[model samples]
Target: MTSPPQPAAGPVSPLNSPLEPESNRKLAMLLLAIVLYIGVLLLPTPAGLTPAGQVALGLLVLVVTLWISECVSPANSAVILTGAAVLGLMGKSLTPGARPMKSADALAAMLGGFSSTAVLLVAAALFLAVALKHTGLDRRVALLVMSRVGISPARLTLGAMIVGLVLALFIPSATARVGAVIPIMIGITAALGLPINSSLGATLMIVTAQACSIFNMGFKTGAAQNLISLDFMQKAFGRTVTWSEWFLTALPFTASMSVVLFLASLFLLRPQVPPAAEAEAKLRAQLAELGPLSGAEKRLIAVAVLLLVMWSTEGVLHPFDTTTTTQIGIALLLMPRIGVMHWSQAEKLVPWGTVVLFAASISLGTLLSKTGAAGWLAQQTLGQIGLSALPVVMVVGALSLFSIVLHLGFASATGLASTLIPIFIAFAQTLPVTKETAFGIVMIQSFVVSFGFILPTNAPQNMLCYATGAIRTKEFAKIGLVVTVAGLLLIMLLSATVWPMMGVL
Candidate 1:
């Protein structure tokens, strides 16, 4: 009656049966992330270490822990990590002559990120994204491009990439670009008479994400996070990156990578055939009935262009700095009560969590450097590797890969960059790679971190496409791997030759 020695008859089963293959895979990844984190601790170099090392090690630990827990959402993880780091500082881990945590001081430090120019820009970008959605400006623009390039699925994918890149200049957030482009992509699939679930659409989404991340380098306001990286470079290495100079150096590489990404997508995304001529005609008629750009759309477009002109001609007009651009742009849109979207509407459009993440990540980066964690990390990890240009390149590549793989578990691109770029700077200095190589690699990471195709969470855009079931997991894997490899190679080539010539490194 005692359960007859249940499970003793054979090898006892786990209380929770051994994980399924997928579960086991996840478990392995979690374990691997932990192991890599510990490796960060053991690394040592010639430069004697300090409190900075401890902070960097702590950050690595925090990232792995968040990955394991699936904690307070992806963006929130940044807030938590930053908060923890600041608390640790107050606990004598960061500051010497340590005193009890001051509520006023901690509050100021934590709030500093929210008050940063970058966060405001992202908030404004998100608001504009909402306005774009309400007025259907993005859809109209994307569909028009599709109509012109509808001859082939490959061409359509390229067109989507172009549109995303163009938008990247106006919309600083990857999330905003993805949100804007996703509906238009779906509309294109439906209009082409192709299966809504075709791999082609998924591929197109990936292209948009990657291209958006890559081409963002061409414009100062393209990615708010890039400014963080630039700030670190300047503060750490005494380098100044002018908007025009950065654009000049980054454009060729971004352009080259875009072309390569287009080809890679074409090879990977095999599309289903288009619908019958009559069906296509009927769909076109329905789309036409929706009518041309509404007055609201025109107004939104004008505001967007006005914002762009300000960002682009900042040197000429010099009205407000990049930071003020966000506040100004949002005010212009929100004040005018632009079309259907009122000031209240802007509230919903902005991802406050993301803004918080931006703040938190910047705060974290600042702490790492201020606490000397970054320098310690550089000494420990890269110090022993031997100073050589090749070794530095290897370090950059390794860091890029590390950030990218971590992206699988992260839902926010800014969050991923915020967590990893500080660690990267720590290690980058130890390498013999030129300044340009280091900068380019770090920039490339903004693109690589969003590159995976394995799951919907890899990027917001991918998730949107996945919702349509247009992409099989296997298809995403194949396309993602190819694009990822192409991106790395392009980064390497540019770092080796192009960036150096531009007087960057």
Candidate 2:
């Protein structure tokens, strides 16, 4: 039977008609952001406006394009931005030698992002996720989770979130994390006699929120974009975001956010009591279905632990670090003897588009820095915006907010980070805050880029989780709003007081 047509919100104006309202909004937003970007570029600068302004303008254009189509593919958008930069330089709009836009050099420069430990680590982690899935290890674990954890509705939701977060440390990709876990979550929730829609909805939203948030803090290779942001900060400012330091800086926020999320889940998904017999039977069924761990699972666990040990003690463990761990894992993945991931399967597993997007975005950021575009814009805009510390704080906050909003349009975190970090770095140049503070804010923004409460295209993981229908739009909004605000505040406190006391300032 055909489903009834949904009711319209209001009489649709030409601008609001369903035929292309969203696309039109996206077009308008893209154009407006581009216009604002040009304004930022034209603002008076010490060097008579640098190429960084044009670079920033190009990024704004990309962001707009992404918001509209939600299908341009972030990597392609990055490539286009690079092309625009070259054209601008060629046409003298960005100044001669403003950026290395030659195809050969830009291609080479963009590829450098792949060499980072962060990228390799994530690739390793993806292999690990695939291995677990292929071997049925994840199902076994999920079964154990449902049986060992209580069947109470509230506990189940929390359990699912925890599972998703833990998996992310090893899984790397949000899509994989949710894709692997949501089906299992739905099965377990249904077995417990809970409403699939509301329970699953809230749980999945929490999963997306927690996965992105914790990964932002947990490992060096937690997320691809985290590495991109780190690379930009270190290359531009000569700083290293050590795993220990990253964890320490993000620990308080992570813990606070996790707890807040748990409470938020409870409130949003009010768990009514289920029939005791039915719940126990469902739990028993799930547990009974689980079998012994397979060879692949055993092998993967051993390899994963080895990788973790190496990550935790990179300095002392035979000079291995995140990159080495990833390389080793990938090598194992390609080995026929391992039988974990064949070359063909492994090739499919790597998110090559994401890798390309990172490389291109970084190249763009680098181009801005080289052309003196970033510094010029920083001097022009920050000088007029405010000369005081408080104003700088507000600017950082606003940038963070802009990044989050841009998430609705940009599908990838690295895309947003690479596009914005250079501009932020430039702006911070005029402020009194240390480079670390500015970069730290940028790092925080990268994490927040995974936020997507309303639309499916916000992030890959968000879309994957949303497809499960476990979380509703309103429910996501309620929890996401709280997390977003709290997360921003946590960063503000850390940047303003904690980091200052630690001499990061």
Candidate 3:
């Protein structure tokens, strides 16, 4: 495909550079955070909130502000927020007349998230992703699919997307899926001699990132945020969300959105040049290089299929929980003789930052709900916006829009879920819908939180693709805006029609 025009060379003057002011900007963000903290603390406590809840709210504001401005990395922000939560609870306990929050209680409140089953599941899933990468199976599958689809650019893109959807079934994490796919797509660009700035290169990269995020919604384990939401639902309302239920509810939207993403990429980021006839031959040669599947590949494939079957049938089979199944799968992958990956290699590939972020977010979300902050804020905000007066469908649409817009201010989907899901659960209580209907609405909001297409920082996958420099921020924004709008409309349409029919609303 034809490449975009290269930027003209310019002097490397640091002071006059556009990014030169970032340090000052971060400093300003810190200052703004301090001011916001003070402002929230100074305001009279909202009705129905305890002192602890108000303190939590202040901390939430500071954390959200710092995260949006990126005064620090998201992992660091999560750590800082965790510390704030601890100190806030401790400070409340120190007050003479206040109920005593014991040191053990405070510690449990902050550290509990680290011990979550969801966190453990993510850790195990990362091992699977690492095995796929180390064994080169991910690339083999990509090339095999491309070879079968031939060399047409549109067909290649479609084939890549289909491969992504299939991977989502077994690979739980979107970040992991992106890691597996990007290098293979990059190699394709190199094989085709496409310029880094070529339309085809950018399209392939953007498509891979976008498709990963879209398919993440289709399965229960598609994203860590999904698990977090399910956990919250169980704790808040004693509701259990099964794999089949999640699949049936989310698959329709995910499938439709995937089509929308494919069409959008095809039209908005179509290759500028047609593929050369030799492209198919090159892909076949690459696939041929892999030769036959090794025993390791066969073993990993067997274990992955077993894990998928277990996850899909967990509710009916009455076997082990999803977390246990994952743990068992990890054990099989690490078996001495049959293992496809070594611990040292898998350890290196494990995303510790994501683990920490997930744990901290879970801790923060638990605190927000337990402290009554989520409920208080939900009530006040909804009342202020007259949300309680609107029809349930309108409220759902409003929340869908709010969820999408709020994502712009947060870099991590799990972080956004931790912040918004609790508030949504509380807000749902204020609606006129039945408890089941309210839960369905909350679930919809939770799904929307993963729709992080509007900004590169909205998802790690987006950031990974953007790091290649093939896709500019404006270029991403152009497609992101359209996809986001389409997504919002789809959520509304489902909420009004499909959800009610499915008894979700």
Candidate 4:
């Protein structure tokens, strides 16, 4: 006999199901992190930490968790973190025998990120990128470079990487560089009649992303984290790392790694359709169609050249820092009819989320350093590693590797640096090395933190390319693993040889 029919199934309950909307899941995560924060705060203070430090640690734990989970937008998380810090400081002021931080000091600690030179520089750089895009200069540069490289896919890849390197020198923001380049590369792909998800398209996208990340290490202003690292160096070690010094120290390693990345992409991620004679014809046609640069492009070039000169000579000719010089460039760009673009146009291109995220990260990092939270955390974690018993080079390598592994949980390079740099500073002191050597080790660790290419969420550059649908996760992972391993080995080599020769060791 046939079995009786089952009753019709009812709608699934949200309380018992995992299939909630993404927004709902994110909200749950945010609430869970808040609860964790409260639990940590209410628990007894751990040894070797002040009450204020304990509070700061709790906030840091919550923020890091939220960031890693991406339970909220980074900007929103930053705002929440800043508010929590202010409240935590206020609570400390009310505690008996606590060293009460003044309200002004607390405000500064919570909101000072907005006033950072790095943040301002990034803002100005956004405007500059907009100017380049608005005047068609970015596209013109891309076509010019591609036209000269011929129609071979490998040659085009090299040309794109070279353009990325050149842009890194002047642009100073990896996201902006990717923003400027991806569209041009996409145009090239379309001109060649290649599908967006074709192997060639994927290769070009990955190359652009990888090149942006690799070259970020070559220049001090290439990434926001580089500036954060320098700030930490000056504050914690009484040492200043000028742009020229950073370029001198990091260029050797970055240039070599970039070559490895290019070769790896060429060999491992070879395109499905190699560039043909028609591809060259298409590029030339595109160039011929655009004809010559406009008056706007000419003015932008002058302004960009002036900005580059000022940045390269920051500590030498003018004594104006990178931020000051950028401000000057922005002023010229926005000045009357002579300006390349109006404020309205430039403002539209600015990535405001990045601005808020970096500012809050800097503020949080400053608090972590000032309140001794970073030091205590470092001592508790690395202190147990018995680093003193290991060779100095070995210790540096371990720390560098740890920084790379840690990036799996961090979406923002600035967040990773802000969290780890202070701890590395403390970890350096525990090593059997000179103060200068320790400083150098910390700087090296800072550089490795930028190697967040293994996952799409690791860096914005990766995420942007991933959005193109040209690359599959496994495809990216395959290349990312090779590059990451190569990068780690290179860092180890530098720590053993180049760093010592440079007196960083």
Q: Estimate each model's TM-score.
A: 0.79, 0.81, 0.90, 0.91
Could you tell me how far off, in angstroms, the CA of residue 282 lies in candidate 4 after the best superposition?
Answer: 1.9
| Candidate 2 error regions (>4 Å) | 1-47, 51-56, 82-86, 91-121, 199-211, 276-284, 287-290, 316-318, 380-383, 391-402, 405-411, 433-457, 496-505
Candidate 3, residues 1-505, lDDT tens digits: the string is: 9999999989977878888799779889888986787688778977778777877788789888887788887778777777666666764642335576766667777788888888898788878888888888887777777778765678768877987887887777787788777777776777777876688888888888888888878888888889888878878888767777888999889888988888888898877545556676777788888999999999988998898888888879876888899899999899898788779878987778878878888887887787788888887776589988887778888998888888987777887888899899988977777889889988988789888897888888999989887898887888788888999889888888898999988
**The candidate that achieves the highest TM-score relative to the unseen native structure:** 4
Clashing pairs in 2: 52-373, 200-470, 201-470, 201-471
lDDT of 1 by residue, 365-466 (tens): 777676666666655654655543454455556666666677777765565666667766666655556665666556555445545444556666566656
Per-model CA lDDT versus the true structure? 0.64, 0.63, 0.82, 0.82
Better of 2 and 4 by TM-score: 4
| Candidate no. 3 TM-score | 0.90
User: Per-residue alpha-carbon lDDT of model 4 for 247-266, expressed as tens digits?
Assistant: 88998788888888888888
Q: Which regions of candidate 3 are displaced past 4 Å?
A: 1-35, 91-98, 273-275
Residue clash pairs of candidate 3: none
After superposition, the stretches of candidate 4 with alpha carbons farther than 4 Å from their true spots are 1-20, 93-105, 272-275
Query: Could you tell me how far off, in angstroms, the CA of residue 502 lies in candidate 2 after the best superposition?
Result: 5.0
Clashing pairs in 1: 45-380, 52-372, 52-373, 197-470, 435-505, 436-505
Off by over 4 Å in 1: 1-56, 67-69, 91-103, 191-193, 199-213, 216-218, 237-244, 275-283, 316-319, 337-340, 387-402, 405-410, 429-456
Please count the clashing residue pairs in each candidate, in the order shown.
6, 4, 0, 0
Error of 1 at 23 (Å): 15
